[model samples]
Target: MGKTTRYRFREYHVTAVADPMALPIFEAVCVTGEERNCAAASGELHAPEELTRWIAGHCAQTGHQSYEQTTRTIVRAEPGAWQ
Candidate 1:
């Protein structure tokens, strides 16, 4: 008979981190009309103001009031205490 084998698994917790070296990225898309349109905008992760400014400019130029914003952030997973 084969020897009995066992394995252990550990739980992990994921959290977002803003590292200067690997700054998160912010992406915004204009969705004002019936169909998705306009060029996508992207900027630094920590600075949302820049994205907002771009959105405002796009809205003003294209008379668009609606927009979809996507934030891409870095995350780290750490093992949690064994339960």
Candidate 2:
């Protein structure tokens, strides 16, 4: 019998929020996957969704203290995995 390899995947939601004063500030909101604990597989959400959720949550919590906002998200996938 041949040996089988196991894989894992994790997703993180990175986000950023800025103030209207032209000061670019950013933050990260991590939404990890089930296999995130595994050191093998890891992944993250695309850009748009990650940024949006981050900003929204930040604003909601902080009472929309900032203005003229921009958002961005990123996906980090593990190597040697069939995504």
Candidate 3:
């Protein structure tokens, strides 16, 4: 008979790390009406303050009063020591 074989598996921990090379993107969309959605507004990698200002402006101009915000962030995951 052939010799018995053995295998081992290692466990790893995962966490999110920010990418220094890329900035987070911020977007906002007006959700004031039920029938249609307004064109999305983006900060294009700008800070949250900038996006908030844009949303406020949009709300004032269109009387939207309601909006949905989205933030896209670039992250990296590194494997930790085997456990």
Displacement of residue 58 (Cα, Å) in model 3 is 0.6
Q: What tens digits encode model 1's per-residue C-alpha lDDT throughout 28-55?
A: 8776667646655544545788888888
lDDT of each: 0.69, 0.43, 0.80
TM-score of each: 0.65, 0.25, 0.74
Off by over 4 Å in 1: 1-20, 35-46
What digit string (tens of lDDT, one per residue) describes model 2 on residues 18-80? Answer: 333443333344332355421211123335465567656655654543333333333343345
Clashing pairs in 1: none
Alpha-carbon RMSD, candidate 3: 3.3
Count: clashes, candidate 2: 3
Q: How close is candidate 3 to the true structure, as a TM-score?
A: 0.74
Give the range where candidate 3 is weakest over 10 consecutive residues by summed lDDT: 37-46
Instruction: Please state the error at residue 40 of candidate 2 in Å.
Output: 31
Alpha carbon RMSD to native, model 1: 3.7
Top candidate on lDDT is: 3
For model 3, name the residue pairs that clash: none
Tell me each candidate's RMSD, in Å, in order: 3.7, 17.2, 3.3
